[model samples]
Target: MTFSPTTLGTGIAGYNFLLRTRATQQAALANSPQVARDTEHFREKLKDIQTSDQLMEDRAMLRVALGAFGLEDDLDNKAFIKKILDSDLADSKSLANRLADKRYLAFAKAFNFAGESGPQLPDGKSAEDVTRDLAAIRTADDLLGNTSLLRATLKTFDLEGDIGNTFFLKKVLESDPTDPASFARRLADPRYAELAEAFDLSDKVKDRNTVYGFASVFADAAATLETPEDLLEDETLLTEALRVFGLENDVYRPDFLDSVLRSNLNDSTSFANQLEDKRYAALAGVFDFHEMAQAALAEEPFTSTLQSFVTTLNARSEPVTTSNDFFSDIKLMLETYKFFGLPSRSNQAGYVNRILNSDRSDPAAMIHGVTDGRYLALADAFRIEEPNTDRIYPPEFADQVVTNYLDRQFEISIGESDESMRVALSMERDLGKVIGNAKGNDSRWYGVMASNLLREVFETVFQLPDSFGTLDVDRQLKELKHRSESYFGTSALEDFTDPDRMEDLRRRYLMQSNLQSSATSSSASIVLSLLSRG
Candidate 1:
C-alpha cells in the first residue's frame, strides 16, 4: 500500500523514522513473505512500544530475529525494525524476558538511540541516572581505549596538543580517578597546572581575590613595623613575606627567613652576601651592579669635562657661520663614534681634552696626539691632514677642522652606503667654497680633504662587483640631491659645477682608477706567488 503525506508526520525526524520503517519492511518482504507477516503480527501484538520495559523486550526480540537470519542490528532505525521482522517467535519471547530483567532498554537509550526523542527508562531510573552510569563508565582503560573521547576531554582542558604524547598519557593513566589526593597531586604538578587552571579543577590556583587578601594582610603587618629589624621576629609576617616572593615552600624554614630579614638593603656587603645564594642569582642578574657602580663614579668628572668642552666651543668667534651649538654637535660626534663600535669613553675624554686645550688659532695640533687605531680610522674617514710641527694652521682653520670632523662623522653614520659617497662629494663642493672665499687661501686644505674623501669613496666603489654605470645611479643621485639640498640648500647643485671643484673631481677619479689598477696587479702577483710555491 502507498503511504500518503498526511500518514507521515510533518517533523523531519518523524518523517525520517517512518521512511526507515518503510524501507526495513520492504527489505524484510524481499527476504521472505513470512518475515513481513511476522513483523505485522508483532506490531499488532504491541499497540504502542512507549514504555521502557516494552522497548527492552522489543529490542531483544529484534536482536534474536536478526541474529537468526545473519542480519546486523545497528543503532539505526532501519536495522532495528529489520531485526524485529526476522525474529523467530519462540526465541524472541525468551530474549525479551532476559532483556527486561537486565534493564537493557536504558543502556540502548543512552548510547544507541538516535534523534531528539526522550529515553524511556524504568520507573526507578531517571535521565540523570543514565548520565551517572555514563560518567561512572569512564575508567582509565575505557578512556585510553576510546581515542576520540580521550582527545575531546584533553581539548576541554586546553591540553589537546598533549594527546598522543606517550609520557603525558602515561601520567594521566597512572593517576587514580577515584582518589581526590591523586587528582590533587596531578593538579599540583606545574606541567599540568595550566590544564587544571583551564578546567577550573584546582583549588590552589590563585585568583585576584586570593592575591588581594594576601596583600591586605601584608599591608596591615608592614604598617606596624618601625624598623627593618622588626621583620625578623614576627613569624606570621615572615611566612607571608616568603609567600609574597614565591618562596611559600620555604615559609617553615626559620633560618632562611631570618637570614632574609637580617640582611640590610642599605649595606652593599649585606646585599652581596644575599646574592651569593643560588636562589637569588636570577634576581641579582636582572641588575648590572658593576656597570651601575662605574656609571655613578664617572658621572661627576664626565659632566665637568663635557661642560668645559661646550664652553670652549661657544667662546670661539672666528669662521663665523650658522649652526654653532657645540654641545649638540659634540654629542652627535660622540654618538657616531659609539655607533661605529670604536673609541671608549676614556679615549673620548682624551679627544675632547685635546680639542679644548689646543690653540684656537690652529686646530691642526689636536690631530697630532691621535695615534690609536680607532682615531686613525676617524682621521682617514674625515680626511684630516696630519700635523706638521713647523707648520701652523690659520686662525680660521680651527673652526673648519672642527666643523669638517663633526660633519663627516655625522654624514657617515646617517647616510646610506651609496649615499656616503654622495655626502663626500657634497662636502667637497661645500668645502671648495670655504677655500675659495679665504684671502691668500693658498693652502686649499679644505678642498684637499674633501677630494681625499671623494677618492676613498671611488676606491670603495671600484672594489665592488658592479661598475658605477651599472649601479642604481638614478636612486643614488636622487638621494644625494635631496640630502645636499636639505643640508646646504638648493645652491649646492650650482657649487658642484665650479671649475676648480670639477678639476679636483676629475683628478680624484684618475687617481682612483690608477689605484684600482695597482691593487689588481698586487692581487695577481700574490696569486702567481702561491701557484709558484705549489
Candidate 2:
C-alpha cells in the first residue's frame, strides 16, 4: 500500500483505525438484531484511516517506503528531488510538487561551473586557432540566443576574409554601404590590412556615403590589374574605377564597335594620332584588309599597291540604299571609276554583285543599273540622295577624267586609290593603242577590234542621243563610225550574208552598242560597225 510522506513523518495512522472499527460494529449489530439492529450496524462499518492507530504504529515502515521512492521532504536534500525527476515511474503528486516550484526549472539551463562538464580543449592547436574556434562557437550560440552579436561577428569575419583578397577588398570598398560599421569592420580585417594601407582606407569617416567613396579609391588603385578576367572577378571595383575615370558611359557595346569599324574604311589618322601604342596606331589595326595591306606596305610596296588597286575597283560598288537608285547608281559608280581608267571591269562588277547579293537591294535592279549606259546619270541620282560621291571617286579625281585616264594609263594603276581605276581604264584604252601599233595598215583583227568599238559607239548615239544628251551624241557617233569603216572594209559584214544571220547580227550590235554608249557617253562606233558588218 502507498502512503503519503506527511502521514508517515507525523505518525497519524492509529487515529484512523479506531474510526474504522466503530463504523463496522454499528453495521453488524443492525443485521443481527432484526430491523432495529440493522440501522445501528450500518452506521459503524466504514471509518477514516486518517485517525488510525495501526497507521501510527507502522510509521517507521512508511518512512522506509518514502525514502525508497525518493519522497524525502528535507529542503537541503536536492539529490532526492533530482532522483524523483529521473525516476521512470511517474507519480502525479510528485510531478505536481515540481510544477509548483519554478526555481528548479530555471536551474536546469544555468551553467554549473563547479561540477558539470565543459567543452574540451584541443591538443596541439595554437592559441590563436583556439581563440577563433571558441569565438565562432560563442558567435553561433549567441545567434541561437537571438542576440545581435552574431551579425556583428559575421561582419567582422567577412572583413577578415576580404583582407586576404585584394580584388575582393576593392569590391567591398566600391560596393554600396548599407551597413557602414559592417563595411568598416570588413576593411579592418587583418588580411586586408595591406590593401587598406595601399589605398588609405582609414581617412574616410564611417558613414554609408564613405563606403562607396572608399570603393572609388580602391577601384582607381586596382586599375593596374591586367586582363578582363581579373577585372570581372572584382566587378564592384571595376565599376567604381570606371565611374571615377568617366569610362563607364563611354564604353562601347558590340553594336557600337561594329558601326565604328564599318564606317571608317580609310585609316582614322586623327584618332590613330591620339593613341600612344603602335599596335593600335591605325583604325586598320582591327580590319583584316588593312592589316594585309599594311604588311604588304612594309615588305612589298608593289604588291600592296596592286592589292589597293584591286580593292578600289571592288569598292566602287554603289551601296544598295533604295530601289530606284540601286541599278542606276551602281552603273554610275562603275563608269565613274572605269572612265578614270580602272583595270578589269571584273573587280568593279564583282563588288556590285556582292552588295546586291547581301540583299541590301533588289538584284534585278542592280543588274540593270550596272548594265545600263549613262553611269554618270546614276551618279547624279545618288548625288541627290546621299551627296557623298566624292568618296566614290578614286583619290585622283580631285581633278579631271578622259585625258588623265588615257595619258597616265600605267601611272593610273601604279598610284593608290582612284588612280588604280584610272590606270585600269587607261590600260584598256592603251590596249587599243597597242593593237593600233601592231596593225599599222595591215588592218585585220588588230584594226577590227578598234573599228568594232567605233561602230558600236555610232549606232548607240543614232538610236538614243537623248540618253547621252550631255555630249554631241550624233556628231560623235557619226565621226567614230566613219573612221572605223574607213579602216575595216564593208567586208566586215560580208561573212553574215545569210538573211537570217544578218538580222540577228544587227540586233546584237545595236543592243551591245546601246549598253556601252549609255555608260561611256563616248561611243565605240568603230567597234560596233565592224561587228555589224561581220
Candidate 3:
C-alpha cells in the first residue's frame, strides 16, 4: 500500500499531484509496519526516559526523537546532542546558542531534560478535565502521582518552572501557610505563599484558577505584599486597591503615596491618619506591612473566559442552525463582546451571520477577509466551523511533544525521498502560521529564512543567488524584500495567506528547480565530453 515517490516522477506536475493527496499518503504511511512499529516503540519507551542520556541510549526512540526536529543526521552525534541539551541556555556562548541553525536549540527545548521552562500541562487536556483531576488529589502521594495536576497548580501560581523539582514541591505543599517562617513563606517570592494558600496539605484541596476578577483576586494579591514598595510595583493590584479606597487619582504620585503607605496608622500624627478623607486611612490599614490579609482568587482569566463563552456560541452561530434559544443568547453575546472588547456587529445581523457561518481557515471565508487582526484572532479562537476543544494544560504538553515528534518524522521521511516535495509540504503547513502572527513582515520573513526547507524554496522561486544566504541578516532581509516586491508586487507575508498564492509559490519553485536541474545536467555532459576528448 506504500505509494512510492518514484512513480510520481519529478518537478511541477508531480508536485501538484503530491500536494493534492498528501494527507491520504501520510495516513497510509502512518499505518504501515515500518512507521507504525517505530512510532509505537517510541511512544511506549518515551515515558521511561526523563534525561537525554536515557533517550540517546534507545536508538529507535532516538531516531523518532531526532527525526521529529529534522535532526536525524545527528543520530551518531549523541555527545554533541547531550551537550546542547544540558547547556546553560542563559549563556549566549553555549553550544546550543552558538549554532546558526536554531533547530538544535528547538530540539533541546522540546526535550527539556534540563528543565528550561519547568513543567506544563500535557497537550489537548481541557480546563474541565484538569479541574476534575485536581479535585481528586487528597493526599501527598496523589499530588505527586498526578504530575499533570501538580504542574497545572504550579502554572496557575506562575511557578511552572519548578515542575521537575518534585521534592521541593512536596515540602512547599506540606508546609503551613499561616506560619510566616515556614518553607513556603521563607521563599522571597510571594507567589510561593499564594501557592501555599491555594493548597491545603492535610487532604483539603482547592480549585486553582489563574484568572482574575477585581474583587477577590486583587484581595488575595493584597494579602501577599510584604512591603509598601511591593504593593506599589504591581499596577493591577495597586490600582484596584486604590479604587477600593477612593484614591484612584493618587495612582501617579507613587513616591508620595509610598511615603503615606509607610506611615504608622497606629500613630495619630501619621500621614494617612492626618488626611481629612477617611479612605486614605482605610487604604493604609489594608496595605500595612504588619500582618497579611488574604482572599481567594476568582476562576478564569479574561481571554479564557471569553473563549469559553464563544465555545457555547458555535452551534447557534450560523444562520441555518436557528433555534429559539439563539435570540436570547445573541443578546447576552453582544454584552459579552462589549465587555471583552471584541468587535460586535450590533445592528448588522447579516454581517454577523456570515462571519459566524464562515470557515475561519478559508481565505474566501467571511471572517478571514476581515481587515482587523483582533477580529481575525477572535474568529480563529472560536473555530466556529469546527470543533473547539481546549488546548491547555499539564495534560496537553505531553501530547504536544508526541504530536510534534510524529509530524516531524513525517516531514523528515518526505525529505529523504524528495527534498523538493519536503519544502513544498513545509510551506503548505507553516505558511499560514508565519503569516498569521501579529508581527510585521520582516519578523515573518526571518521565520522563512530560519527554516532550511522554507528559505531554499523561497530563494529558488524568487531566483535569489545561492550567495544571498551569505549576506548579513539586514542585507539578506533587503534582498528578500526587494525580490518579493519585484515578483509579487508586495513585500507582505499577509498577502501570501491565500492557499492559491502558496500553490503559485509551489509551481514557481518546481518550474525553476527543474530548469536548474536541466542546465546543470547539460553543463555536466559538456564537461564529460571534454574530458573524453582530452
Candidate 4:
C-alpha cells in the first residue's frame, strides 16, 4: 500500500508536532516506493515538453503539471484549460485575468506558451519562409496545384487576410506585365505588377529575345497591311499588337477593331477616339499603317527597365554575436538572472559577451570567477561556448516542478484522514504564492477569495457565514480587510509572510475548524458517534 502521511492530532499540540516533524515525514513520503514512482514517472515524461499545449496532450505530463498546482481534478476539462493557458494575463479582459480564481492565472504563467517564445528568428519555419519555387511554376495550372505558394504570394502582396479570388489571381498571372493596362497594371497596388514580373505569368518577357520578337513581329505585320481589315486575317499578328495597347480582349471583335484601327486618330469624332478608354485610340495610332514604323519605335514594347526590379529577394542570415542577439532567442533566457537583485544588464554587451563565451567545463573558467552569480546562470542557460544544448525550459525548471508535484501530493494525502488539516497545510503552501503574485491588497484579497483551500480556512477563522460569499465583491473585500486587520494586526497580507504570523494563523485555523466540527456533531440529533480526529 502507498504510504499515507500521518497527522499527529487535531489540537494546537498536534498541529505543532505536525509542523515540527513535517520535514522528516516529507522525506519518508518522498522515499516511499509509490510516491517515488509517481515523481519518477512525472520527471521522465516532462522532459520533452516546452509548451502548455504539448503538456495538455500528454495525460502523464498533465497529471503532474495539474497536480503541482492542486488542480489534478481538472484533468478532464481540456477545453477550459486550453482557454486559460492561451490567455494573455496582461490583458484584463483575458479569460485568466477575468476569472475571480487567480489559480488559473498562475497555471498559465507556469508554462507560458502563448505569444512569441523568444526574440530569435524562429528555429522552425517562419512567416518569411512562406515561399514557392517560382522557377517550377511554369503555367497558370502549375500555380493552382500549389496552394501554399498561392497563400505565400497572397501574403507577399499583403492580401492574405482576405479570401483570395483565384480567378483574379490567374488573370494577373496570365496578363502581360510589360503592358501597363494589363490585369496587374489595372490594380491600385503596384505590388501586383511585381508579382507578375516575379512569375512572368504572361510569358511575354521570358527573355530579351521574346520581347524583341513580339515588337519586331508587330512592326513587320503593320508595314505589310494594305488596310486594317487585312491585318485581322492574320490572328497571330493581330493578338500580339492588341496586347501591346492593352486591347487583347478586343481581338474577338475583329471587324469593329479593324474599323477602329482604320479610323483617323487626329479626329475626336472617330470611333477609336470617341471610346471611354484611350486604349482603342492608342491601338489605332500604333497601327495607323502610315506611322507604323515611328509608332512601334515610340511605344518601345517593354524596354526591360523593370528587369533589375524583378530580381529575387535574398534572405539574410547574420551570425549571433552580441547580447542583443542572444536575447532575441528567449528560450536561452537565464531565469536565475531575475533573482540577481540587480538592474537588467542585458544591454551590457561587454560583460555578457565574456559570460556567454566563457569555457564552463574548465574549473578555472571566467564565468565561475565572477562574484555575480547571474553571469554563471547566463553561461549555463546559453552554453554558447559548448553550442549544442537543446533544452526547451531551463534545466532547473524540471526539478522545481518535480518537487512541487511531490510536495502537493503529500499534502493532499494528509487530507484523506482529516479534511481540515489539508486546508491548513494548503494555506501555508498557497498563501505566499497568492500574496507574492498580486500587485496590491485588493488583488491579494481576491486571490484568497478565489482559492478553495484559502477561502475555506478564512471563512472558518473569521467566523464568516456561508452567505458572506453572496455579498458584492467590494463588500467582501471590505469585510476581508476588516477581519484581516483584527486577526493579524495588519490589513496588508504581506505581514503574514513572517513565520510567526503564519504559525499563528495556522493555530487559529485548526482551533476554529475543530470547534466547528464539534458544534456540528453536538447539533445533530442522530450523530453517528464516528467523529474521531483520526
284: Cα error in model 3, Å: 38
Between which residue pairs do clashes occur in model 4?
119-328, 120-328, 120-329
Off by over 4 Å in 4: 32-34, 89-92, 115-391, 525-534
lDDT of 4 by residue, 435-474 (tens): 8778898888888988778888888889999999999989
lDDT-based ranking, best first? 4, 3, 1, 2
* Model 3 Cα lDDT, one tens digit per residue, 1-534: 543433276787777677677677677766877667777787566556666677788988887777766687899998998898787666789888777566677666555565534323323244445545654554556787876567756755668898888888777887778888889889988887777666676323221111122333454453346677887898867776565333568999999788677767668898866876555555565454432222113432222222333334333423212222234576545633432334345564455556656764677777766654333432332324442333222434434554666666566667677777677667765666555533888888887787677788889988888888888999989888888888877788788876777668888888888788889899999999999999
Candidates 3 and 4 compared: the better one by TM-score is: 4
lDDT of 2 by residue, 348-383 (tens): 555543433332245554434443222322232222
Where does model 1 exceed 4 Å of error? 1-237, 243-256, 271-275, 278-534
Give each model a TM-score: 0.17, 0.14, 0.46, 0.48
What's each prediction's clash count? 1, 70, 16, 3
Report the Cα lDDT for residue 405, model 1. 29
Local accuracy by lDDT, each model: 0.39, 0.32, 0.62, 0.64
Name the best candidate (by TM-score). Answer: 4
| Number of clashes found in candidate 2 | 70
Tell me the deviation in Å of residue 432 in model 2: 99
